[model samples]
Target: MSLPTPLTAEAEDSAGRRTDVLVTVLAFTGIAVALVQTLIIPIIPHLPEYLHASASDAAWALTATLLCGAVATPVMGRLGDMYGKRRMLLVGVAMLVVGSVICALSESLAPMIVGRALQGLAHGVIPLGVSILRDEVPAARLPVSTAVMLGSLGVGGALGLPGSAMIADAFDWHILFWTSAALGALALLLVMLFVPESKARPGGRVDIPGAVGMGISLICLLFVVSKGADWGWSSGTTLGVLAVALIVLPFWGWFELRTPQPMVDLRASAHPQILFTHLAGVAFGFSLFALNLVLPQVLQLPKITGYGLGESLATAGLAMAPQGMVMMAVAPLSARVTKTRGPKTTLMIGAVTVGVGYLLIMVLMSATWTLILASCVVAMGVGFGYAALPTLVMSSVPASQTAAANSLNTLMRSIGTTTSSALAGVLLAHMTIDFHGVELPSENGLRAVLALGVGAAALALAVASFIPRHRPDAAVTPADAIAEKVGLRPAADAD
Candidate 1:
């Protein structure tokens, strides 16, 4: 966390300007990428008619994006560490622009899926942006900058939903992609103009074979989790993929351990500080995503269902938008808590807040205002947890490993979210009541899912509690990291 103390006043002035530009551009880029993820949600059910495809076939549009993003996140992060973080960042955003254009122009299922896969490649931007800030920004501004950047993940997705829903309602669905393309282009221009390439490049060739092995294993594992309900969990195809993942993962771990430049450093990951933080990431992710699954359905279902409020898609989106604003508002608190109480305490507070929010949701979802209040409460917890996670990772690992390490942490959250989606789908499908000719999720089923969310948040709090206390020397500068181990932070002071 040490700095050069700005050898001269003029140099300090220029440094301050660059720091401002860097933080601003990175936060905008994070929002741009996150917005693209949710932009397609409003149109998912109508995708079959829009592309003249079967319902099963149309679902691939969303599935493809998740798979591509899962694989691309860590791979691109490793590439960033080797080449340059800002360079890989630009490449990621460029893919988003290209993907948006393809989706905007598409008239068939194949092109839309391809475009989605391209958009997914941009998922690495958030982690890479954090890594770049670590390298280029001053120690004092680092915590706040990282909090703002991380909060953008929630902000972009929350805001995008209503905006995209409105666009789809008013115009051709293709207009949504066109709008996304325009935003991507704007982000590209800003990054190119303001963000500089990080000088903290690691020296090593990429572990091509290791990367391939890791990618294949992840694709299989996530495919089972994401599509098992549709594919029949016990079917041969699903069983075979599950079996392949189980077998391949162990071998992949073995290979990575032996390889000179591993895709993920197993030895380092095994450290308690990094390990518990990642486990917390998964649990925290699972807790937050249940809100997304439950709110939209309650808002859009038939009012005759008694429990359903019967709002339109656009209105449902608006109902959830406050969560983003809550996350943004909590960003500065994330910085303040981390600086004073230590990231471990901040993360613990977040997990408790998420648990309490879910406890309220289990009772308070009878009305829209109550639901929105519950969502905002959960989002405040997420902002705190998300901001603290990268801080913990960066503090624990060396500067050279920041991109790879943070990317892996992000992937862990994706795994949690995917699992939550699958779990909710199962609960709702089996626990349904007949309304007219259709079966719909019963109120009890929704409560069961919210109860699960509460459990996950509790688990996250438990995991966060296990993180080892930080020593004063936890964060070594990039220059210091080159010659020695990372610095550990001192015990927390009474700030």
Candidate 2:
């Protein structure tokens, strides 16, 4: 089978004798960063006791990381586009290393949460890796390399959960963070040794105000989504935060539109295809997290609940592990679909598959095997859908804006996931079923959460229908085509 190459030979050839090895190392480094993000999940169940935290407070271990990543990703992307990907990547790696080490050595949850926040900056690696493809690899290798790098976003987290579970079960929870620290160290070494400095934006100035505005807006928005359930969704705190987000987001948009070298070029995101991609990213990200968060609760419930399988943390992780592996396996095929039918078609297919997967889960709520099957379907759909998204975004935007553009895409996905987490929490809290007067499904409250996922996937399908399709051999490059649709000047020709 011939692989689609997106990079020119001159680009790949410039790396000399170590190009292949370097690419492999960088890919793994990207994977390690992904692993760190999720490696704590299996241990979440143990955190309350280990850290002497109340159940609600313990959730912050994950929430803090999510909040930090949501704020940092787009900012890092803009910095990478403005300054250098390698520089931002190295900074991210350093943060991850420090965070992991602190978490590994911490005696309390406060320090651990602090560490996780620092590690959140590492989420920038995935987009930076994708942007690197535009700068490095030979044109012939760009498609597959791009697919693999982006696919790692899902694959890394999926694989990390099971591995974390096994490690925690065999050793102790601290070992998981320590192992993550080691992975961070290795990633730093690989990045320093292999990834080349990008020439895309050698001397651009950082847009400090633009970055601060965007960051504050995102933090406010994500804070509402992440903590609204705990703070009372209608409480003054939550409503006030949402209002601030509403006020800041428009100003941030206006700021980006007016800045000569904005942190993120808002004009670039106005394209029909790009806009649809961001909207789809929200739905897709919601589906991914909904499944990840709910399935384990369902599987680990007491068997007396009638619907529960009573699995251990390790068993639950193993059950959901196939989704990640399937996603990895399907990503290359998704790339082919994009190459042949275009991104719009691929996205539609993914949306339909995702909806079908959720429908399957809803139908099989009474069976354990159904959970696994539904996960497989969802993973396959997400792999295809997720792979096509960055391709669509990158193809639509200029190479110069790859990092920032992709980061915005990533940020949208995070927003989706954050909203899903809050929404699912509220829905689960309200939808308790009285099972033999015992309320068996009330512990983790997941069935309602999965139902919300099904709804989100359906919305994704609706959004996918509006994404514009293009022919494979069309005269317009992906970025140009999107630029034209959005009425923006092409980046290559834009001053």
Candidate 3:
């Protein structure tokens, strides 16, 4: 075969600039989307007062986001694959901006839940961005680029805690959502200016029936997990939702199995490599979110409780800020590891590190510095695992299906996080001690949660260990090969 023509110097420089702009914009977009998850966390305890609602009702602010995100992620991914990734990405970002504005103006629970749910719809941006990178980035640079994108999730979440806490302390809480709106607007502008629409349109009809079925099942499952404690585990509402989830799952499976262009493509997902990766995603999700739940509470609780640090919200946030930095710093290194040892090995290493971090928290919880140290350790592991999970997922699936596949992986992690929150809530609630007329979480309660985190980490490692070893190269679509051959990508990365 004849060799392809080389790009001219100016053309090559232009391609480099475009690639740089694309990666940066998409990574920022991911971070922008992620910030929504943590923005309300600082104000959760006070939500009842602000919204003129009962504690049980105020909790729906968090649950709304989780439920909406769980349902939206996979659907958006499939839509991106069918329509255009860039188009669907823009829609997600726009929803975030709109959601934030509604939240900023809200004075009651109803609007706040609506705003938060809209924000949750944007969760698809990160995975969609991953799929975009798979379609657009040069094969040689894919690992490190993908690592940075995945790392953005940790960075955004890590920074959001401290940042939102400080804002809540200093200003009206409305400012929190306003800030998110501004960030979302910025991400939207950057995407419009720099990010190009992907050319890999695996055009097909959307599985609307499948989407509806899956959405209903996810809503039921997440509703039961998030509200079961408040509704009473044995209550009719909880049991009814749980029963609906169980009942719908089998039917959903049956429908998806029969559909020609199913939303999830269950047949491909059944492969040992993909199946195990998704399971590992759930384990790591539980592992990561458990730290988020435990650290802030342990740091902010009254010192009279003996195990509490009694720090201000802002201080606790500042202490944990290092974790996000550590996550960003370690992500490139994880990419390097993926290049040398494989993504599976990198993930296993992350699991062990996370478990060690939780172990440290158990043994050393008296000082803020120790919490910082332990959390940073956990962040390092998160950086490694988060970066690797998507890599493993994208590598195993067809390029055209990358968005849907990655979204499903993300959904698994969401399931893990929601489950972690529920279990932690239950443990902390019943395991409380009476402190001067108020019930406070006992030391053992906190330890039990930490122990759960350690167990989650170990579970992640075990699940990752079962991932079938494979070559690192991702399957390229014919369009990708054509684009690369025509000098649309950088030759420098080919080194």
Candidate 4:
């Protein structure tokens, strides 16, 4: 099979420097966005007191950002594909800057939450960046850049925790946002100076109705998931939002199918491999985030609890830092595995490893070393699984749909994490214990949440087994034919 000619002449003219520099800048842009998301986590405990806000109210700072991200990501991605990545990158960075400035200056929860929502717009960068890679970079260099770009999700979040903690320790929490804002401004400048406009899709139209519908559906779904535990899962408000999501989701799907230019290509997503990849993305994201949400709580719980370690926030962040290293170390290996054994085999191995990690945690929760080892194992699995997922989705779908398809995949992953957060909250709430004269698990409930993670990973593993392991170099089949008709390029020529 012939690869696409090394970047088109016009593309080459636009990309004068080494494509790697541009790719690195794009990758760093994505990493900066991710860092904004997790950087605040380490500051959460202190924010409530500093802002004179209730803990529950302050927590919305995180939830609001996630909710907005879940709603805006697909819309922004489609718009990026339609308009231009360079323009959108600048817009997203502007949003991040404005949001960070607002967050930095805010003395109350209300303004802070609004700033965070604006920052959510930045989440579009990665999907758009991934699509841009296909548009500009040589095929030979694309894979490694793609891997690093994607790997930033885990690495950024991991590094942000410690980095943010260090900042919080040295200065006030406001400094964190100020630092992020500065970084975002730098990214915006880099993008404007270095990144070229994408080759726009001719006659492409924004799917306004589809975008609105999907946006509303996601907003409702994420709202229920993010707020369910706080609002009472079975309460009228929670149930009402959930009911709206259930009704709107099918209609959104229907609308996407009927639209001339759907926000996301529903038909493309319906492909079996694509569908499975999405499902696996959801599970993997849920399980991976479970660790992020729970590990700190587990480590920081007062030692009065039978299972507590009582570490401080900085220490907890440090403890989890190693997992990021493991993830980075394993990512290239995962790419090689995909190249040799195909995405399915790599995915299956990753899922099984994740499940085994969770099982190890469940069975051996007596000491800190066990938790550290379990985290490393899970990170390795996540690195492998995360690497394979985009490869599978990108390979299965047409290149034309890469941004939308990957955005949708990213959306599913967010859905999984959002749902897991709610579920874990509920489980922990119900599983609190009274220990000696004090209440253990009352402040930070983790055991039940970790157990739920294990179950999710197991389910992910089971689903991974069903994904067909096609040879990476196999001849194009009927699916490839259909993809071509729908404007998708085959796997070998995908990037």
Candidate 5:
């Protein structure tokens, strides 16, 4: 046997290098998508004045993103499954870049809302990136890689808060979107260069009826949840919309079950493992967003209110920034736990950790350090929970259906977050302290919100406990072996 030349050795090294590039690119892509979620947070309060719109109209800047994201995630995921995951991912990123540029240049409500809605369409990027990772990365590297890639959601959102806050504070508000646009463009370029297209396309025509049914049902339901506070939760219009959702969802489920190549495989998804995982997602989402909503308000409100931290946006962001770091730092460890014990065990641990965080902070709401400590705890919980989800999902489904299955899981989280937003708004808005003739969230209200978070985490823990432990001969979708043979084990398979 002839020994290899140096040139040949370098060439072999490059092949190894490509894998790292692919994982890095996909992880950053996930982070960039998450950054878009929080890009406008610092400017949200002033949007009405900046855009010369009513507060309600200005609020659509946020709502548009949330609504569009909910609808687009599953749609894009299914499209990725049928066509190509990387192709859809690029398309999603392209929308974000374009949307950011539009928002960057806009000075009016209509354009800004349009831009934001466009941005929302790209929210599927995270899940698609996960799907892509599952398709391309080696099994030995998958768990840590999965943890890092999935952790981007928390890491990006956490960093975005402080990063955008400082940018908005220092420069024109447009800079926030411009920064997102630039980061998104970088992500796009990296993906094009590094990520390979998965050959596991589940080729078929999309189920249009099923898609439309799910869209309408989600839109109506989320609309009520997101808009009910502004629209008057008890108003006839709110009740009417809620009625529409209640009426439509059952029919939607029926259509999905009957459709060929359904957008969401209702029958497969009804498996206890997948079902309980998604159920936990809803509770996890609720617990996660409640902290974001309540913490910022608590940090920035006047200290005269007793519970308020009286911090500036920059300062509050600084205080809260540790959460993102904690999330990133914990990902590898979380992956380790999943590998050793099982994802179900990891998720249960995360749920308990998150519950403990909320419960601790409810009693320790006096100082900045305690808030930081509590936030980090919650972040750790998010890292563990988020990483476990993809594992749970990939295990339950086949490689060919990875994107669609994960997309559904992502959708469940959105539902939980949206519900959390509405419920928290009601709690904080109604429970108030009068300060200088203006009402602010009372200390009790903040504590109550924390209590609610504890409940949500506890709920997630309970649901996750019901997830069947992974067994040696556990079933996977028929496509798993093929995917593994093709060098991409779906979802960084459990150890």
Candidate 6:
């Protein structure tokens, strides 16, 4: 065959512009999906009244979403690997739109819970987005693109809180879901218009049994972690679910190890570098969520409590909003550090920064501005840490396995956040001071949670330190090999 002609300067420029559009759209889609997580936080207190249900029943609106997201993350990742990442991503965003509409039109708890559960599936977008970047974005641009895309998690979550609060404060509560639906629809449209399908398919049949086993185990485990406090730690229901998860996990692993095309590659994950990266992901998750929990409580509690800031919910959200902006700002910086010192160093720095932020929070909780400053510090750490995680995973795994590996990593973080929420809840629940006739979380309890945040950051830093150092020239991943073969990279560089 005749040699394929190289692109002209104008064609290359057009390609560059397309790549930019792809990254921008993907990042926007990530932020839109993430918004679902915090959309209900502002209206949580009034959920029971709106649904005409008991408080315990209404809590399912939150719990269902968490459980669905946990179940969906790994399964969706596996499917994306088998099929097409962009196709799966579109499906995920579609679920968000449908779920949001269901929630918007709901008059009772059942439909609301269903809608939230559907929205949870959108969590898969982030991992799949990162994987797509690996497949399509030029290697030079990959780091910054992935960093910004990953940081959208923090961005959407931070912006959503105050935006949702302000909207809820002024309009009917249904407007929140309506707004979510609109955003999801817009993201879905933009994604279809801009993001290209990934070519790195590691052709494999779905591991049906493995998926089912893993899903059941995760659901049971996460359910217990998230609801154990309210259900009573010793309650049979909680213990039973916990027991099921514990029993199912070993079997799931055993089956996965034997399967030729496993839903999750246990061997790859067990490698020290990938394993440590995952452990660090958990630590980062705990730190991020713990900060989310403690800061808001400290900000919104009655001012009569010596430690509380006594701000309204909207104001508290606005104060926290700067952290999201900081995270976005730190993304490019994270990419720079990853490019220079390596992702391991980036993660370590992030861990240290996060620890310092938590320390600041402990000392600075008395004032809103101080708390904002401390949260911004934590956001910086989270941005750096989140950006580093996928880069590390992608570097180690084959291009074909990126989505699955990244999904598992994301799942680890979810587990960490869930554990943090549980621990913080228990501490705040038991350590409360009487404010008039009601009990409120005591300063000591909140302080303990903040201390745990510090401990989590330290744990992440320690775990990240153990990750094997990456030398760009020393490793050629499957993706790199493919890119080289396909002329996506210069042959000299490939060698």
Q: Which candidate ranks first by TM-score, i.e. highest?
A: 6
Please, what is the TM-score per model?
A: 0.94, 0.88, 0.95, 0.88, 0.93, 0.96
- Model 4 per-residue lDDT tens digits across residues 58-93: 888988889888877787777776777667778888
RMSD per candidate (Å) reads 3.8, 5.9, 2.5, 5.1, 3.7, 2.5
- Please list the C-alpha lDDT of all candidates, in the order they appear: 0.88, 0.78, 0.88, 0.78, 0.86, 0.89
- Model 4 TM-score, all chains together: 0.88
List model 6 lDDT by residue over 151-175, tens digit each.
7887898899999999998999999
- In candidate 3, how many Å is residue 188 off? 0.6
Off by over 4 Å in 5: 1-16, 472-495
Q: For candidate 3, what is the TM-score? A: 0.95
Given candidate 6, what's the lDDT at residue 415?
95
Candidate 4: clashing pairs of residues: 398-488
Q: Model 3 residue 35 lDDT?
A: 85
lDDT of 1: 0.88
Task: Locate the minimum summed-lDDT window of 10 residues in model 6.
Answer: 1-10
- In angstroms, give how far residue 128 of model 6 lies from its true place: 0.5
* Candidate 2: regions farther than 4 A off: 1-23, 138-140, 434-448, 473-495
Better of 2 and 5 by lDDT: 5
User: Number of clashes in every candidate structure?
Assistant: 13, 11, 0, 1, 0, 0
Native-referenced Cα lDDT, model 6: 0.89
Model 5 lDDT per residue over 1-495, tens place: 334567656754664577678777888998899899888888888999999999888988998899899999999999998999999999999999999999999999999999999999999998898888777665545667788888878778888889998998889999999999999999999988888888898689978888888888899999999888888989999999999889988998888777777888889988999999999999999999878977888888988877788999988888877888888899889878877788899899999999988887887778888988988888899889988888898877878888998999999999999999889889989898889999888888888888889999999999998999984234343334554454433244444
Q: Write the residue-wise lDDT of candidate 1 on 1-495 in tens digits.
A: 343243444555766787888888999999999999899998988999999999999998998889999999999999999899988999999999999999999999999999999999999999999998898775556778889999888889899999999998899999999998999999999999998877778769889888888988999999999889989999999999999999989999999999889989999999999999999999988888889998898888888898898899889999988988888889888888888778898899999898889888878877889989988889989899998999999998877889999999999999999999899899999999999879999999998889889999899999998999884234645533322232222222312
**Model 3 weakest 10-residue run by lDDT:** 1-10
The residue pairs found clashing in candidate 6 are none
Error of 1 at 459 (Å): 0.7
Query: Candidate 5 — number of clashing residue pairs?
Result: 0
